[model samples]
Target: MSATTPPNAPQGLQNSIISFPDPGILLVLINRPKQLNSLTVEASYELDSVFQWFDNEPSLRVAIVGGVGKAFCVGADLKQWMSNNKKGIPMDLPTNGFGGISFRHGKKPIIAAVNGAAYGGGCEMAINCDMIVASASASFCLPEVKRGVTPFGGALPRLMRIAGRQRATEMALTGRPVTAHEFKEWGACNVVVERGQDVVDRAVELAKLVAANSPDAVIITREGLKMGYESLGVGDSSRLFLEGWSKRIYEGRNMQEGLDAFTEKRAPLWMDSKL
Candidate 1:
């Protein structure tokens, strides 16, 4: 939504959405403010390409996913939804899912900057992200049940895992909207910002901090800590993720630079290093 692009971002993506490259952060914005930035079928498919691109491009570090206009993403176009379902189309498809890019998960973090009410799939997109920061004016809900539909795309399980089963069920079943404050209280929103302020600015501040670190170290540390606890029944998935990264760290100069910077009590310089 900001006019200024991140390091390598082009003018903008389709639907006024843009992708800023470099500095490891990709900005995926929904640009249909006139319709409250409603998600269209084409927009959804574009999102699939966006995420896929982010995953394949090694230069990308993290993503800041948000929307344009008054709301972040109001949800699917009901008009489109009615027609699509009648034909036995699957809403869970990769391009039509939240952001039109469902089914793919990124290893890097994605910070959801909820600018307004995120209903239905919008809420699902925010919840699935690695972190969420909402404006004070932001609200969240899953009203799909009211329409005889269910949020089958990861929202139900994620809410239960992150906010507890009771909260998840209450939200899904009742179709009630929750305030940003309540979301923060439930540990679902990492930061609650003020209205008219910049969630993107805050996110970029966080992004720069993350990008300044040793990429390999960050990757390994994320994999290690993400493994959770043995008492929690952690498995080989985390180890498997790390096995590939261990070789990168062993051979990368970024690791040595981080150590040297610490010894010198100076800031790390890693712009040219692999992340």
Candidate 2:
């Protein structure tokens, strides 16, 4: 429950809870409860660093990403985003994107323990994980379109591929939230439990099962799967699409209106035509 990182943790992990909750598993909790675990620029890089550390650590077989309070993560901190945007500062997101694992390609497995509402970039973060264990109270959504912003966090393409074009399109277009049960039915979540704490516990159990297997065999199997995905050009296509789409969206007037409306606690007044 402590938010402080262990002494052995990397310097960048101050904003997160990095703990060894299981014998061969790492637990990473996004610690900004007041902000609904929003991803600030610094937090995003630190999370990426933590995941990189996890990938290299021989003793850690798996990792779980969760949030500190009611939200798993609500995506980017709009306040920070607005401030940075106004200052003409660019959002230098890592190659991994958003929460550090959104676009990451690694041999090690990671599970998302969705304990509460995961929206926008948060939904993308969960989708990026190898598996998801969600609490019954948890919900997921991609509401960026309503705010006049596109979901360039790999969520759009990946969700289309994962949940089919129809479902993904509906969710993205409508900005409606889906329950954990619905996501489980859609195959996005592996398991759904009644309580938040149980979500992490279930993920830990699954991690233990993975950790018990042959490490080399697991890595090899994952690499083979990754190769197949690469051969199909999934990663590259998504990256290229995001690069093109995000540039226009981030620099457009609608994006500014969206951020301003969000900060003012009002609905965005989107332009009639696309930029």
**lDDT for each candidate structure:** 0.73, 0.81
The CA root-mean-square deviation of candidate 2, after full C-alpha superposition on the true structure, stands at: 17.5
Across residues 53-149, which tens digit of lDDT does each residue of candidate 2 receive? 8787666667899999999999899998999999999888998999898888875889999999999889999998988999999999999888988
* lDDT of candidate 1 over 227-255, digit per residue (tens): 55211235575556557567778788877
- Deviating ranges (above 4 Å) for candidate 1: 1-12, 19-22, 95-97, 100-102, 224-232, 235-244, 271-275
Winning model by lDDT: 2
Question: Which pairs, if any, clash in model 2?
Answer: none
Clashes of 2: 0
lDDT of residue 200 for candidate 1: 78
TM-score of each: 0.84, 0.79
